[model samples]
Target: MFIVMVAPECAPVAKAGGLGDVVFGLSHELEIRGHAVEIVLPKYAGMRYEDVWDLQPSHHDLWVPWYDGTVHCTVWFGYVHGRKCFFIEPHSQDNFFGRERMYGYDDDALRYAFFCKAALEYLAASGKRPEVVHCHDWHTGLLPVLLYEQYAQVLGDQRVCYTIHNFCHQGLTSPEVLWATRLGRVDHFLAQDRLGDDTHHGAVNPMKGGVVYANFVTTVSDTHAAEARYGDSACGLGHTLHRYQDKFGGVLNGVDYDVWNPETDPYIPAPYSASTIERKYLNKEALRERFMLRKSWSPLVAYVGRVDEQKGMHLVHHALFRTLAAGGQFVLMGQEQKHNGINGHFQHLKDHLNNNPDSHLELSYQEELAHLVLAGADLLVVPSLFEPCGLIPLMAMRYGTVPVVRATGGMRDTVFDRDHGEHADDRRNGYVFQHTDNQAIDSALQRAFGLWTDYPEDFRSLMLNGMRADHSWHRPADHYLDIYEHIRHK
Candidate 1:
């Protein structure tokens, strides 16, 4: 079957967070399942055009009536995990994506609306009618809206499935989007939930419209699905998600072992497998010596991901101050990417942490460094207030680095607290805290440290257990195949 994937971000091209990881991981697995998959994303200025310059040129310019403007669509073709990937680059005059950030835009609705319409038109023109048009996140929410409003009659046979990687980034359809994209018929979108909750108290909400319109909807994890069904973790779209609970579900994300495997990985210093467990320790000692970490007494605490508030930076920062004071070796491998503002967020963070850079603290966003840190660390910390299937902790677990994460969404589902007194065997993956506070992080860190220092034998056992666990996409890809077969008729 031919699958069309539309996302706002992808890896090795343009990325800000886990959204890119999901796009690359899932697309790779889908392709492995004998399905021809293609991806569509905006040609942001930050995209690595040099890497994908070989994709054949296959796009054109189209104008929307009354908008007094033209939108340029450039098509690029490639393969990810043996699956054909087609990427779309949308050119905007006002530097829509020219900046070095992924989010924070007032005109996002207008941009992606034109993007969805253009992709459908391109599909029709190129004679490439996919069996499923899989739209991801609120960024591509307009696909279902446009399909029902415009493309359904012409491409009525194709089914549309929308995956909500993050429901918060809605492409709100305001008067600008309604008029600029040439979507057609404002009354049709407005009268009685035609466009779902794109308008809430005069404000537009595009994420809600996706839940209402898609043939099938999926979150990143089963726990996230449950949280979204309730009013807790929906990020203001809980009621909307609850309304569509029947068709909504979650697929616990899987890691790409090809990129994360310790044995074959080129990033880590000492390559080791499940059998050569002792070599990973050498990597840890090498990591300590390379980073100039002097606190060999305490268990090394590590962090990797976006250094933003949502990642519990407020708490992680506080815990860092406290944990380091308590004689713990702390290493953070991350970088901050501010969307669009007069001032840069990275500069602000550097000004705060620049006082000392030679200690256990290292701030670099390079992908290879992230893999090295994961392989070398004793405990990986992910204090995300809300995580959409975090990949770092999973990678950490694969490398025998225990994770200490906040028990929320995917974090709650993946990391298990072995010290919780029951299911000790199954719960030996990592440490977890429920409350999104520094207090919780402090306690979890203490418990993880306790296991690392006090119970060296048990800690080694836990590491061995983590290495043996199967977190790969092998099973999840089968589940996705089941989903595809179930929705094949649509």
Candidate 2:
């Protein structure tokens, strides 16, 4: 099978969050399974070239359609982590994708719009057609629309699959921006209910466009798919998803063991496995030292993610204080959202930690520190209001760190509650809370702390079980392959 993945982010080279890990991990897994895989991403400024293999220029030139006119762009080629990569660069004063960061620009809609057209232009110009084109998130949502509209002739019978990593980002833009796609007038799509944004009337939503046109759609987890269709976490696309329920499904995102495994992870100071679980404490001491904490044997609880309200940062803050009162240590590694006042909250955590003996707070995203914390911490916290298949809990599990997560989305699917023991005795991985309230969080923490304090053997058992669980890409990749074959046959 020939597969092409189009995403705005890829791990190790260009990454913001789990989306990057998913793209790079899935592509690499597919290629390892004997399928030819290629990934298309915009060549953003300051992207580390050292991460790309045999990085060089390509003769491929693209004429990307804009609202007013078409702009020329140069296409560069490279191999990232064994998968073929295409980096498109637009030469215009607009400076699309020329920023230091991958996202958070006012003109993101325009930048990604240009990227979508340029990607197809490159594929058409290069005369390469894969059996399946897998588009990830809203950043590449327009690819499916472009394929069916403008490039159908050149890319014949190429099935498109769109995966919604985060439904919160619908890529909504003004209807006039449709002119840039060269997909004909937007009125027909709007009138026919093909590319409409039900939440915002008369707007052009690229995600909705992809949903309406793509052969199939997938979210990060089966539970997340259900939520998007029937639950409150749909991000205002429930009607569209429900209408296309048969064509929409969820597949759990897999953890890249090569990068996250405690036994071989290069980032962590000490390599330890389930059998050598005591070695994990050395990493704990190292992490504490790195954060300038007084060495102690207290249970360490850590949180690793964005400090947004949706992630239940407020609840996490509450949990942190309670944990400290209970004599348990806490460490947080996250960045604040702009204008969200999370910076002040994080500062408060830091101030509390300054007086506390074994507490630490880092107001940034440090991948190396993340690994060390996962390896070191006795428990990882994720109290999300509504998570759509989170990866942090799974990563923590791989490190033998029991996850304490709110029962939502991927966290609900992945983390089996040790208290309930619903699954096999050996498979109960972590603690799960039903509500995001302070009381619910306290109950979970009490259970976790009890296991760590009085039942050391049981705590070790839970951690070892989580470490031995299968969270790798092998099964998920096979699921994706099945989806591709179904699409191709249909």
Candidate 3:
């Protein structure tokens, strides 16, 4: 199969979140399976140039239509994660992807719209017709619309598999923004069931357009698919998903063991596998020393992710104090968005801690620190209010660190309660909570702490179970291949 992935981010080169990890992991796995996989991403100014192998200009002047005129783009080709990749570098005065950051710009809608068009222009001009044009997130949501409505003659009738990683960010923009995409505002395209944003008057929802036009739509997990269709988690797109229920489904995201495995991890102080789990404590000691934490036998609970409202930052804050109250050492390594007020709260909490011996909070994301935390900590907390598919918990488990997550999205699909499931004795890998409240998380934590404190052997068993579990990309890649084959035939 010839598959081409058009996404905004790809790991180790340009990444903002789990979306990049998914793009790289899935593409790499597909290539390993003997499929010809290629990726197309914008050549953002801040991308890690050193990671791209043999990057050279494929096309110097690929003209792409803009709002009123045309802008030429430089198409570059390279290999990332051992798969072919093409980068579209727009030579426009607007500086679409020339910013220092990957996202959170005022002109993101217009930028991505231009990117979608430019990616198609590159593919068409390069004479490549992929069997599956996998579009990811709202960043490439407009690709399916452009491929079918605008570039069908050149790009052919390729099957588009639109994967929605985060439904909350639907790329809702002014109706006038469609001009940037060169997708004119015709009544057929502006219909309520198509690209129109029914909830927001005169707005265009790119994610909705992808879901409607693509042959198949998938979220990160089966439970999240259900939530997006029947629950309020889709942020007003539930009806749209429910309307296209026949073609929409979910597949749980997978972790790239090449980067996350404890046995081969170079970031951790001590590398240990499930059988030699006793040596994992060396890393715990190293973490305590690195964070200036007082040495203690109590469980070390860690939280590593973005600190935001949707991530249940309130629960994270509550967990920090609760962990301390329960005689556990707490370590948090996360980045906070400035717009959210949680940064101030965490800053104040940090000041109050005053370098407390049992607790440490770092307000920024350091990839190395995350690996150390996961490998060293006994428990990893993921109290997301709504998670599409969290990769941290999966990576944490691979390091033999038991995850304590709220039952939502992929967390529900992956993390079984240590004491609740029918065959939990054998299948349970972590602790699961039901609600988004502090009490619910506290209850799960106390059980985890109790198991570690009193029943040491059982705690070891739990950790071993998590370490033995297979959360790799192999199965999920096969699931995606099945989707591609199904769409190809249909």
Candidate 4:
């Protein structure tokens, strides 16, 4: 199968979050399985060029239709992680992708809309009819729409598999922007069943269009899929997902074990596997010294993610104090968007906890430090109000760190509670909770702490259960290949 992934980000090159990691990991695994895989991404100014091999221009002039005019783009080719990649660099006065960041701009909807059209234009010009043109997140949401509506003849019979990483970001923009796609009859797109935004009237939703027009739609986990279809997580698109339930489903995202394996991770001070689990304590000691935490044998609890409300920051704040009160140590490494005012809140917490020797807060994300925190921590907490598919818990579990997560999204799929799961004795890997309140998270944490403090052998067995579990991309990639084959036959 010839598969082409059109996404806004890909890891080790232009990564903003897990969306990038999935694109890279899934594509690499597919290529390894004897399939031709190619990735198309915007040539963002801030990409890590060092990771791209044989970087050169592929097409000198490719014209893309824009609102009221056409934009000329230069397509560059390179090899990223041994996978063929194409980067579209637009030559225009708007400087669409020349910004310092990959996303979060005033004109994000328009920029990605233009990118969607440009990606299809490149595919049509290259004469490639891939079996699957997998689109990731809202960034490339317009691709499926444009592929079926505008470039159908040129790009013949390309089955689109649109994966919504998070439904919160639905790429809502004015219906007028539909002109840029050169899609015939803009009024047709304004219909409620097509691209219309359900919540914001007189607006178009590219993600909605993908859900409606694609051959198949998938989220990151089965629980998240149910949440989007029957719950409130779809951000007004639950009805749309319900209408397309026959074509929509979920495939749990996988971690790149090559980068996250504790046995070979160079970022940590000590390398240990499940068999050599005792050596993991050396990393715990090194982490305590590095974070300036008081020397003790208490469990080191860590949180590594964004300091945002969606992450249940309030729960994280409450958990920190509760963990300390329970005679445990807490370490946090996360960053918050300045506009959200959560950064100041975490900063105040940092100041308040300054005199406390059992807590440390670093208000920014450092890749190497994240690896160290995951390696050295005895317990990892992710109390998200709603998580689509969290890779942090998977990574923490891979490192033999017990995860205490709310039962939502992929966390529910991956981390079964040590005592509450159906097959607890066999499938139990971590602690689980249900509600978003402080008490719910605290209850789960107290259970984890109790086991860690009293039943040392049980705790070791729990950690070993997580370490021995397979969370690699091999299974997820195979699942995706099945979806591609199913769609092609349809």
- Give the per-residue lDDT of model 2 (tens digit) for 134-232: 999888888888888888888798899899999887888887667767665768867536877887778888888889889999999999898889986
Q: How many backbone clashes does candidate 1 have?
A: 1
- Report, for all candidates in order, the number of backbone clashes: 1, 0, 0, 0
Residue-level lDDT tens digits of model 1 in 100-154: 6656676667666666777777777677788888888877787787777777777
What TM-score would every model get versus the actual structure?
0.90, 0.97, 0.97, 0.97
Model 2, residue 398: distance off in Å is 0.7
Off by over 4 Å in 1: 50-53, 59-70, 80-83, 196-199, 289-292, 295-297, 337-364, 424-427
Better of 2 and 4 by lDDT: 4
Q: Which residues of candidate 2, in runs, are more than 4 Å off?
A: none
- For 318-424, candidate 4 gives per-residue lDDT tens digits of 98999999899999998666467888999999999887899999988776788889989999999998999988999998998999999899898999999885865
lDDT of 3 by residue, 391-436 (tens): 9999999998999999999998899999898765868899999998
After superposition, candidate 3 runs with Cα above 4 Å error: none
Q: Is candidate 1 or candidate 4 better by lDDT?
A: 4
Lowest summed lDDT window (length 10), candidate 2: 184-193
If both were scored by TM-score, which would come out higher, candidate 3 or candidate 4?
Answer: 3
lDDT, candidates in the order shown: 0.73, 0.87, 0.90, 0.90
